[model samples]
Target: MTALSIYQQHDRLLVAVDCIIFGFDGQQLKALLIKRSFEPEINKWSLMGGFVQQDESVDAAAVRVLQQLTGLENIYMEQLGCYGEVDRDPAGRVVSIPYFALIKIDEHEEELLEKFNAKWYALDKVPKLIFDHNRMMNQAIERLQLKASTQPIGFELLPEKFTLTQLQNLYEAIFESSFDKRNFTRKINSLGILQKLDEKEKVSSRKGAFYYLFDRDKYNKLQHEIKKFI
Candidate 1:
């Protein structure tokens, strides 16, 4: 192929991933966002991501983008969806493949998350995002709600040792609705994932609620068994 033909086949269509990093800080659901460092909306709040390279897969590119922006190498990430609107990115003709992650936020390099000026915005109250990012955020929130209920995946946002109250709070935040404390505890206890700890957290309640750990190994085993049984 000649230079002109190569140029035509270059496929210059810009490809990028927008990461919606969600975390639980023991109280509510939060999302990781960064200030854009490059134009066309330099310094504006946006999801952390970058262009895909010729040698990498979409998942690989998303991981690289997350690491570059937040310094987090391994975290729970899922391909939310693709936002391919022609005018989604103002900088150029680009198709932004959106991805989302749910982590403990305390699990990764905190210094980098802060050094990059990546701020954690409460899911209940988020800032105005750029371009089609608002739509992405909305979809992510819906996904979280659905995933939290049907699948035993909410543990990703909490510490290994979590309290029943903490579990309830996470559900409340995701659902944006109040739940009966007694019923919530009773229901979660039935799941058989929580491992009771002797320790108690008195930071909030004067009575001090007991701390419990969400055993992932057990949950995963049960999950697999469930599929086989079904």
Candidate 2:
């Protein structure tokens, strides 16, 4: 065997990137899904992803796919995990690098998602995914929960100025349970990440609750503190 062929065969691997795109409309959390147009999973609903080209970096490949699907850049995304089970991908032996990205519904490049033939579905209403993509999404959700526990990444899915009720809704969705109103407010207030505004939102209540804005820069610079409410 040729020396190069031997080495290449010994180390050959398939690299793929899966994007878990998260979005939040005014009420519910959503995700962008693309109808698979490739072999092995044609027509299936899948995350925006692709095999990494020989000349591209993992991050570069993810950006390209995200851009092609969302038409936006500089969104919040981090490496979620790796899925390397021998049969994770049915097409062949492949390892996938997963990333979870967050974009506010108002900020999502709707035109781009449309042109790419992608649709946004609520997180709870997401359709079945191809291969191990569902596992990738679960891992991404865990990553988001961890960060949300200590950081202000939750704000990435919220509006610039939102109501306390809206903030609670985001938290409740992540926690997957209803929270006591008094305790929830107290705990969130203790974090000092929000700046209450003078305006009020009349959509959900008649009393018109005041609006608030999360201070992301300050929240990030602050130390990680765990504060839970019943």
Candidate 3:
């Protein structure tokens, strides 16, 4: 047989992409879960996912899944890993690549979420999911924690301009622990990746905390030499 015929001789397995979507709502880290529309496990909580099309790459499939479910594009996403256990999917022999995405909580389209029966659950309170999705969620959280410490990726979950308190709250939510205010502030300032503005957020206090913007340009310049966030 020809080379093309030889490759086609093997059994075919399906491939799918699942997204563990993460967001921050000022106080806690949240995950977006949808009620599965169809399957052996219909109406069950699951991560947003779809089968990879023949014409598209896995990365493209992931982006398509997120945009279709959330109606938001240009998101911050990273591949977590692949899961290819013999029976991970009950319906078929399918290999799944899971990706973790960070999105601003308020930026997602509300109508799309409602259409998909999607809801944001605090990471600590996420209910049991269908298939191996619960395992996917746990792995995504672990990856986010590691990424947060070594990189400034947590900012992707926050608003464009945020107070230091808001910034700390996000980190605390990700790590599921509290941080000392003085130490956190000192470390943040030393990075020199933030631009402090004269504007202040007065909602939480009379004195008000100043707002700061993450300077991507500055961070890009200093990324090689920057210290761990925690």
Tens-digit lDDT string for candidate 3 (121-153): 998899999889999999999999999999999
What candidate 1 gets wrong by more than 4 Å, as runs, is 1-11, 224-230
Residue 136 miss distance in model 2 (angstroms): 1.1
Candidate 2 local lDDT, 1-230, one digit each (tens): 89988888775679999899987776677778888887888989988888999999999989888877877888788987688999887788999999999887777677877776799888788889999888888888888888887667788888789987888898878767788988889888887777888898987788899999887666666545534322
Span of ten consecutive residues with least summed lDDT in model 3:
221-230
Model 2 CA lDDT for position 92: 88
Worst 10 residues of 2 by lDDT: 221-230
RMSD over all Cα atoms, model 1: 3.2
Q: Point out where model 2 deviates above 4 Å.
A: 1-6, 9-11, 224-230
In model 3, which runs have C-alpha deviations exceeding 4 angstroms?
Answer: none
Best model number under lDDT: 3
lDDT (0 to 1) per candidate: 0.81, 0.82, 0.95
Q: Spell out the clash pairs found in candidate 2.
A: none
